[model samples]
Target: MNAFDSVVVEVADIEAAACFYSAVLGSDSPHVCLRASQDPTSGFRGFALSLVVSQPGNADAVIDAAVDAGGRVVKSASKSLWGYGGVVQAPDGTVVKVATSAKKDTVPVSRDVGELVLLLGVEDVKASKEFYAGRGLSVGKSYGSKYVEFAADPGHIKLALYKRRALAKDVGVSEEGTGSHRLVLSGAAGPFRDPDGFVWEASASAPLTATA
Candidate 1:
């Protein structure tokens, strides 16, 4: 079965974004370096986000499949502004990005960023939970029967289903007008909500020790 691999966030500043993710996910700062485009031996260079996937070679192919499956390519695969490999946007309007290295041994190792969690605002939490459960996800935790969290991988809550109104209230928003706000979480593993009504969370594979 096709399982989750990684979630990408498109930020205006790559450095800032990396910093924010590192702090929020409780992971070490991302490795910073310049990519050598002129060197044939040196493949494309740019910012890189290390994520876990069963098939590393299929990273590009999986993205292609996502596009074919109805996901839009918001940002085509290319050298990102942050100096890493990346792809943005999937069929559901969710953005997914990736980075790679030319030197097999030098490829950045991804820490166990806990579990990549996604908060999906649905009309009905129960139905959403049921739908995902039928699709191979296991129900993990629930809160007051209002919100439900699902696990796609061990140590990671893949998705969190919540009611739109309830979410707004949790953030102290009235929800009278267009629910628009960005919630940023800082730590090894935490969750945040974007202005587009999508919730995103990331966690490092392991606890952080130091920062650079």
Candidate 2:
């Protein structure tokens, strides 16, 4: 299986993004990395990052931190049938969401994130699933044409796919986006671009192994 190490979100200003993420996600957080890019991108970047925590209070805590650190709330934290979650657009145009299946807090709320999900809003979920399958990522879960999730190694970022329009609606944004996706996934997969125009570069810390 292709183990994705992290995602590098291209931002216009590294300094500002650094501060924003530091305040929002703190330093040395797993899976999300940042790089400086002045790529002319606008509207939805066709992707979003989800921080899955332990409780509803944890979701609120992260959402508050994100807003305080210059992020704008797209959808305020709320309870849904699936879970309690909210959406916020990061300072660099990346969609950040905090969610948990647990409705109530079992323990004190902290900034601890249980999992980070990378959701790509693609044109075709099945095609995207096949595209990633070709890159050695196996399917973890699938909901027909509606959604798909790929398995990840322990300590790796979880990847999922949803329809572009639906994802935008879920995050409370317009699906019509142009220019760069402004997102890159670096892992043992080396360099390749997916069918939906997501870039994949090799991770320096975890380079792709040559097949025998």
Candidate 3:
């Protein structure tokens, strides 16, 4: 089965980004890599990292921690078709969605975000789907021409693709920008960039875990 590994973010200040993400994630993560970018500008990153928790209430606490860690609330916690979640902008400009489903898990609750998923917005959903399919990512549930989700292992970050403008509106951002998307995916055949400029790096390093 195809699976998502991890994401790399380019930030102006690696230390600041690390501090903020560590707080939201509960433990300092080896998952989030902070690279120094010669041109760091905050904008709608065109991608969102989702934190799926076992309990709905956990999402609220995460939002609070994210704000305290220098993240800005893009949207407050609320029930959505997908589940209960809200959007926040990490100090480095990465959009994060904290959500929970009705389903329950026995996993011990922690002060950190759980089950990270990488959501990317692409210009053409079908083309993007074809691109990844060629690269070995298997498709799960999908809405023709609108959205496509990939199957992933338990606790691994799941990958999904949605229409650029619609995704931007979902998390409240303008679907416009340039340069690197600042996302890297490990365990792929090799490093590749999506049509919209999202970078995925294939690394042999140990996969990123939801909690430390």
- Top TM-score prediction, candidate number: 2
Q: Count the backbone clashes (under 3 Å) in each candidate.
A: 22, 0, 0
Give me the displacement of residue 157 in model 2, in angstroms.
0.3
Measured by lDDT, the strongest candidate is 2
TM-score of each: 0.38, 0.94, 0.86
Q: What residue runs in model 1 are displaced by over 4 Å at the alpha carbon? A: 27-116, 142-145, 174-212
lDDT of each: 0.40, 0.84, 0.75
Task: Record all residue pairs in model 2 with backbone atoms less than 3 Å apart, i.e. clashing.
Answer: none
Candidate 3 to truth, TM: 0.86
Off by over 4 Å in 3: 1-3, 28-30, 40-42, 103-112, 204-212
Could you give the candidate ranking by lDDT, starting with the highest? Answer: 2, 3, 1
lDDT per residue for candidate 3 within 1-212, as digits (tens), equals 57565666767777777788778874446556556675644467688888877776677778888999999999988876766778999887888888888444345555566677788888899999999889988898789999999888765668899998888998888877676666566755458877877777776444223221
Local error of candidate 2 at 140, Å?
0.4
**How does residue 205 of candidate 2 score in lDDT?**
40
| Order of the predicted models by TM-score, top scorer first | 2, 3, 1
